[model samples]
Target: MFRVAVICLALSFSLLHAETDVEENDIDIEDESELRSKFEKFKVQYKKKYDQAEEEKRFQIFVENLKASKRMQEQDIGTAIYGITKFSDMSDEEFGAFYLNPVISNNNDPRPEEMLSADVAEQLTNVSLPSFVDWRKLGAVTRVKDQGLRCGSCWAFGSVANIESMWYIKTKKLRALSEQEILDCDFRSTGCHGGHPDNAFRAVIQLGGIMSEREYPYRGRNGHCAFKQSKAIAKIQTYRNIRPDEEEMKIWVAHSGPIVISMNATGLQGYRRGIIRPGAYACDNFRLNHVMLVVGYGTSRGYPYWIIKNSWGADWGEKGYFRIYRGEGACGINKLPITVVI
Candidate 1:
């Protein structure tokens, strides 16, 4: 009786191992079915979200890809369909097929000469401010916009705008500072391609500072800057201007408040770079377009970076806000300016 019981136990253990082998063998085949089902379900769900015509068209394309994939080896089919399904969910801008095309070439090479050569002095020699150039010092607190023109003047617009905002913050008055004020009034900065915070700061100081937009409404399109007394609103009062060193920038930022500064961001235009990836802020390859107003800097992914505002209109990146690579001289390597009301 004991021998018979032991033999029965051994037989049961062998059966269990055999069952496990069968389960493992079935997994590969199961994977194919699971993948196919997943695609089918995804298609159905996607169809419901889109209009019938668009859905049908998309479905047809997906079907064609899936069928074509089947002719390849099973392994290839799994990989290809995985990619195909992902492509289906992407928005128009997210699509990378055009980027893959070799026909796309660099827009013009960076010409430092073209970027720096400005006719500000030639154009503005005759234009003069009113007897009283009322330049109001506005606030630095502003809603930064990502106006990804790829022209990269966003830094100039933002920094100058914040400088102008000091007028508002000081006297509870709103002033439209001149982007062209800095552009035309200062030979140091060439619009947006290349310039520094100090350039804008020095320009504001030399031009007897800036005036309100009521005195000078902005003509968005580029033209010869015409200064008129009829446009004269108020003049700005200059307080103590300090170009803070890197350590001083931090001190100023910590003690004072928001300040604008420039940074380098590659392909930051239109934000094709995926959802500000988890650890991407730590990346070192960002490019800088000289901007001003250093607000603050801190660590994000165990690495430090700047929290600078942009001027790319409200429609652009991260709602006109972006992260600058920290500690990389992205914002003048710690040599950024701090301005206050006089």
Candidate 2:
């Protein structure tokens, strides 16, 4: 009877070990499934190969980007922004060269001596301001998202876009102005080689305003200005440089219309979407680079931010716009805010 009992105990222990092995095997399968899913996402997002030996270098880079994105997601605490998992497939270097136009390729950014300057046209010192404002809600922004497309002509795009919005606000009619006109004609700016939107505004004025997109067309390259006084369909009464104060800039954006701005967009390279309060990085105020248009300002999850429109196509960001941490002079948010008074 004692021998029989010992044999039964040994059989029970063997069954327990078998259950433990099954559990461990299940965990291994789950981990592999998750990794496979990540690899699939990389393939679709970057349009790259997952198994090809010839593409091994790019595959390794994509994996590294994917891991960095995962780490960022895990480490960042309640950042009030959306996930960057969408950008997991593209390396930071690839993203920057494709979407960023902070500095032009062959030309230098305008020296302080060369940068165009506009005086403040109006100031709302004590006006009651709204808690939030979005020009898209006002139908001032266009639905057709513009694309800078590997060109340093973002300055021109921002300049033309804001002016177009101003024309809509003033005339209640939307007109697609030609950014190519500015890219080609604005000698002060170097087109794809980079330049200031401040100089871009000056170019529009010098050409007696700009022509419609249908007339001038965007070439995304620098060339001699083909000024056609006949095709000029939109004009700005005057352009102004908004005060560098955050409060005043809010007043201008809410009361006036959309405004153009140049800022240190270097930090925007890693951004995928969401209210981009740049983590672990601060923009150099002295080195303001890329130009963007501020369509509005508001709070997201109790964190105040500015809604900025980029020319890098809708596929790049939050339907062509992104939010940045507002106030505290984030990335020099209020620096060189340019808007037309039309």
Candidate 3:
């Protein structure tokens, strides 16, 4: 229930822009320097409240982890806070919009329903494993480069990709499906890309199957849909929802399968390599601007990693993917499951 509320909260706030009309009115009396001062004050207050809550709830665990890691230090917290709150260029309204507006508007989206259906339960029973699966050990998995194709269906693609990866682990075969097949065929789908993974899952189940991208072909493109290839698609056995639990994720390689998640993409999305500095260092404290697949978890070099595959083209970020540290309690994306047509 609380989990559903969090998802709803994120979705609602995800819609705000930094330069909305309401922002102008909100900071009309303050200049840029004054705005920075106010923002700093607010950040200090926010950080204090955040730290206190975290420490009170999990001080022993957090401190123990810090002690064991050696890499952990008070400096880590200071650096993260400093990095997040260091900006000073915006006017008061813009600065306010950057932080406060999204949080305030987040209240508008109602909480999502928490009911679990009989069909969902049956599917879960049949498809889910008794054992925890470590995705990094899974052999020869494939990555899908979903063309968002001007649709907001990144969420759907993310969900499907994670499911597909799981399917590969269980079935030892790779199958690519056309997003269009699911889009046009699924009645639950909001047309022109305005849909979520739930709709995609229902659509696949409704069709009773989906096709391989090779047979139907993605075309890195969209076109008129044909129902002929539906037979090639597979039916899902069942699935699970693994919401991001920072602690569960600490040993996550042993606790879950592939995960679908979303985040704010750094605008420097197209460049494949080099250190990516998302100019203003925006979104360090924000959430849900982009969706992605968490295919595996491991330590890259010495840093813990969330092996993420993105929708951007192949030229972007380590073969259309990148790794972020699974530390400092950042990147807590919801991981849901989809079943392969078996």
Screening candidate 3 with a backbone cut-off below 3 angstroms (N, C-alpha, C), the clashing residue pairs are 176-213, 210-233, 211-233, 234-341, 235-341, 263-290, 272-317
Please give the RMSD to the true structure for each candidate, in Å.
22.1, 17.2, 14.6
* Clashing residue pairs found in predicted model 2: 104-193
Off by over 4 Å in 1: 1-140, 145-152, 219-222, 229-247, 270-287, 296-305, 324-341
135-207: candidate 2 lDDT, tens digit per residue: 9888898753454345667777788889989999999888888888887888865677666666777888888
Which residue runs does candidate 2 get wrong by more than 4 Å? 1-36, 45-54, 70-90, 101-125, 280-287
Of the two candidates 1 and 2, the one with more favorable TM-score, higher being better, is: 2
lDDT of 1 by residue, 225-281 (tens): 455444544344443233324444444455444455433332232231112322333
lDDT of 3 by residue, 1-342 (tens): 221111110101111121221111133222546444444453443232335654333323322222322222222322111111111222334323332122212334323434222333434434533232335456524553645334444555665675566666567776665566765666654544344565666666666666766666544233455657336655575544433453343333343456665554432222223222222333353444455666665553455556677664443345556665554334334322222333
Report the Cα lDDT for residue 170, model 1.
56
Candidate 3, 199: how far from true, in Å? 1.6
The number of clashing residue pairs in model 3 is: 7
Q: Which ten contiguous residues of candidate 3 have the minimum total lDDT?
A: 4-13
TM-score of each: 0.46, 0.76, 0.54
Q: Say which candidate scores most in lDDT.
A: 2
